[model samples]
Target: MEAFEVIQPGPLTTIQDLGRYGYQQYGVPPSGALDDYAFRTSNLLVGNEEGAASLEITLFGCQLRVLQDTTVAVTGADLAAALNGSPIPGWETVPVRRGDVLSFPRLKSGCRAYLSVVGGINVPMVMGSRATYTKAGIGGLEGRALRKGDILRAAAARPVTGRARVPTAHLPAYDDQVELRVILGPQDDCFTEDGIHTFLQSDYTISIQADRMGYRLEGPRIPHRAKADIISDGIPLGAVQVPGDGRPIVLLADRQTTGGYTKIATVISVDIPDLAQTKPGDRVRFRQVSGDEAVTALREYERKIQTVKNSSA
Candidate 1:
C-alpha cells in the first residue's frame, strides 16, 4: 500500500465514503460524505469505485506529500488546490508523483471539497465503513480529523495507465443561491397556514452555526399552531425541524437518529448535495413537491449519473 503524510491539516479533514447505512437500528446515524454526488464523481474520475473512501476537506484542506505515485481528483468546492506549488484544477484527475506536495487554499465558492485517490484511502473499517463519525469518535485517523505528521495509507496500488479525465460538460456548476425541493412532511399539519406560506416564500440565510449535524437557517420565525412538545420520532436526512424558537434546522449526514421537534418539510435527496455546498450567509429557498415528484427527480438524477459513467466507459 502507498501512503501520504499530512504536513498540516488545514481546518478539518476526514476520510469518508458513500456512508454507513443499515445501522440506524443501532442508533448510529449514516455518517458519510456531505456531498455524495461530488464524492462519487471524484472517485470515478480517479478510476475508483463509487463508494471508495476519499478525503472530505472542509473550508480549507490540508497540506500533504505523496510517498508514491498516485492518481487523484478533487471535486466540490474550489479550494484553490495546488500540487508542488503548481495550480490544480477541480473536476479533472491528475497524476501526483512521489514527494509532490498538495495544498488547498481558502474556499472560493462552496464550503467543502472531496479529494479522491486512485485506489481510495486504506483505513480500518468500523460498522463496515471508512467514514469518520466525529461525534461518536469512530473511523478515520483514529476516529478524528487528520493532523500534522499523520501518514494515511492508500489501498494497494493497481496498475494505472494514466489519469482518468472528466469532460468539462459533465461537471456541475457551483451556485451560491440554491432553491431546494421539499416534500410536505409527517408533521406539516403542526404548522399554521401562514407559517407554511412564509416558509415557502421567504428566503433564508444559512447561519454560521452549522455542521454535519444540521444547517440552521436564519429567516422568518415560523410559529406552530400547537405549542406542545412532540414525542421523539425517527428523523430522516433533510428533515427540517422547527423548534419553539421558530428557526428551521435542516438535518444532514450526522443528524441524530431521532428528533422531537416539529418538521415543516423534508428536503428531497436530489437537492441535498446543493444544500451541502452552501456556506454561511448563502440565500436559499424551498419549493414544495409531492412525494412522487421527489422520487422521480431523484431517479432522474441517478439515471444521469449512470449515463455519464456509461459514456466514459
Candidate 2:
C-alpha cells in the first residue's frame, strides 16, 4: 500500500536496510544505514523487523505527503521533524493520516536520521537486501536518492501501532565531540610507536570529505615507520587507513573491498553508530583498547539493544 509522496527529497535521503552483505568478494560495498542503532530503533518503534527496509535521511530533511494513515518512527539526528506543522516526537511511534505532511525543516543535531514504517518500505530486495547503494545503482527504489513526486509504499498497510518509545536513559547522545574506542590493528606495526601515540592523543576534525564510504580526518600527521602501503588487503568496517599523506580515514559501510594503505587500528563495531551520527567539522578522538575490552563493550551494547527491543514489544 502507498505510504507517502515525496514533496522534497531533502539533501541525500535514500532507502536502506541493514545492508547488502556477503558480496564483498566481488568488490561490492556494504551500503546501508550509517547509524545502525537509530535504524534498528526506528523499525522496532514501528513494530517492524529491525532489518526491514527504511529511509535514511541526511543533513537536511525532506517533505512527504501522507497517502494513507500509517505508523512511523523517526530516530537518529534531531532534524526538527513535524506532522502537518505540529512537532513530531523522536524515538516513538507516531500515527500519521492521509493528506498530512511529514517534514524535517531544521537540523538540530547530528548528521543522519532513520524513518521506518510499520510494514517496512516496499522496495524490491537486491542481493538479499533493499539497501540503496547509489554508487552501484543497485537496490532500493531504482538505487538512488529519493526524488520529488516519488510515492513510497509499504509491504502492508498497518496503521495500528504500539506505543514504542526509547527510554531517555538509553538514548544515544548527539554531540559535536565524541571519543571513539579503537583496537590497534593488523597493521599497527607499520607505524612508528610515536605515530600510534599521535593517533590516540590527537583530536581530528571530520573533513568535508566524510561520507558513508569513510571519514577523512584532518589533524596531526601519523608518522610511518617506513612506507604506508600494503598489498591491498580486505578493508574491514571501521578500518583506520593512513596513506602517505599521513592523515587517517576511518572506513565505514561503503568502504572499498580492499585497500593498500596500512590500517593502524579498527574502531569497534558498536561505536560505528556514534561515529555515523557525527557531522562534518566535528572533532573525533580515538582511545586504544584491548580486544577483550572491545568484546565486552560489544556484548554490553547488544544487551542495551535487547532492552530497547523488549520495551518496544
Candidate 3:
C-alpha cells in the first residue's frame, strides 16, 4: 500500500474532507478543510474524488517522505514548497517517487493550504466523514492533527497522463484585505440599525484569537437592541455572532453546534474561501446581500466548479 511518513508536522496539519454530516445534533462540529475551494480543487488536480481526504496545512507547512510512488498537488495558501532540496511550484500536480522528501518552508500568503495525493488519505471515517475535529477528537487519524513519525496511507493511486493545473482566473487571491458578502441573519432584528450599518461599513481585523472554531474580529463594537444574549440556537458555518463584549465572531467549520450569542448575519457561501484564507492580521469587511442574491452567487460558484471538473474529466 502507498503511504507517507511525516518528517515534520509544522504548526497544525490535519486530514480533512467535506466534513462530518448529520451529527451536529450531537454537538459534533463539521471540521472540514477551512478552504473548501482549495480542498476540492486540489483533489481534482490529483485526479481524486471531490470528497477525497487531503492534508490541511495551517499557518506553516510540514515535511513528509513519500513511502511509495505517487502524484500530489498543493493548493490554497502558498507555503514555499520544495521537493528534496529543489524548489517546486504549488497550484499544480507534481509527480513524486519513493523516498522523495516534500517540505514547506515558508508561509508566503494565506493561512491554510491543502495537500492532495493521487489517492485520498485512507483515514477511518467517523459519522460518514474523515474530517478532524480536534476539540472532540472525532474522525481523522485519532481525531487529531498530524504528528511527526506518523505514517499516513492512501486508498489507491490512479494513473495520470500529464500535469494538471488550475487556471489563474479560477484561483483565489489572498490579498491583505478581503470583503465577504453576508446575508442578514435569522437574528438580525436583535441589533439596532446602527449596528447593522457598523457591521457592513466598518473594517474588522482578524484577531490572534482566531482559530478553526471561529474568527474573533477586533473592531467597532456593534450595539444590540437590548442584550447580546439569545436563547441558544443552532449555529451555522459563517455565522456572525456578537456576544456581551459586542465583538463579532464569525464561526467557521469547527464552530460549536450552538451558540448563545445573537447572530447578526451569515456570510454567503461564495465568500467562505476568502474568509478562510485570512490570517490573524488580515482586514475584513462585510457587504449585505439579499437571500436571492446569495443563492445566485452560490449557484455561479458551483457552476464554475462543475465546469472545471468536466474539463479535467
lDDT of 2: 0.91
> How much lDDT does each candidate structure score?
0.87, 0.91, 0.90
Off by over 4 Å in 2: none
Q: What is the lDDT of residue 153 in candidate 3?
A: 91
lDDT of 3 by residue, 5-96 (tens): 99999999999999988999999888898888889988888789988999999877599999998889998998888899898887788888
- Model 2 lDDT at residue 142: 98
Candidate 1 lDDT over residue span 1-313, tens digit each: 7568999898889999988888988889998999988888888777778899999999885799988887888998888999988899887778889999999966788878999887899999898998999999887779998999999888885645655555666676778799999998889899999999999999999999889989999999998998725898999999999999999999999999987889989999989989999988898999999989988998987876675455431
| TM-score ranking, high to low | 2, 3, 1
Candidate number achieving the greatest TM-score relative to the actual structure: 2
Candidate 3 to truth, TM: 0.98
Q: Relative to the unseen true structure, what is the C-alpha lDDT of residue 255 in candidate 1, on a scale of 0 to 100? A: 93
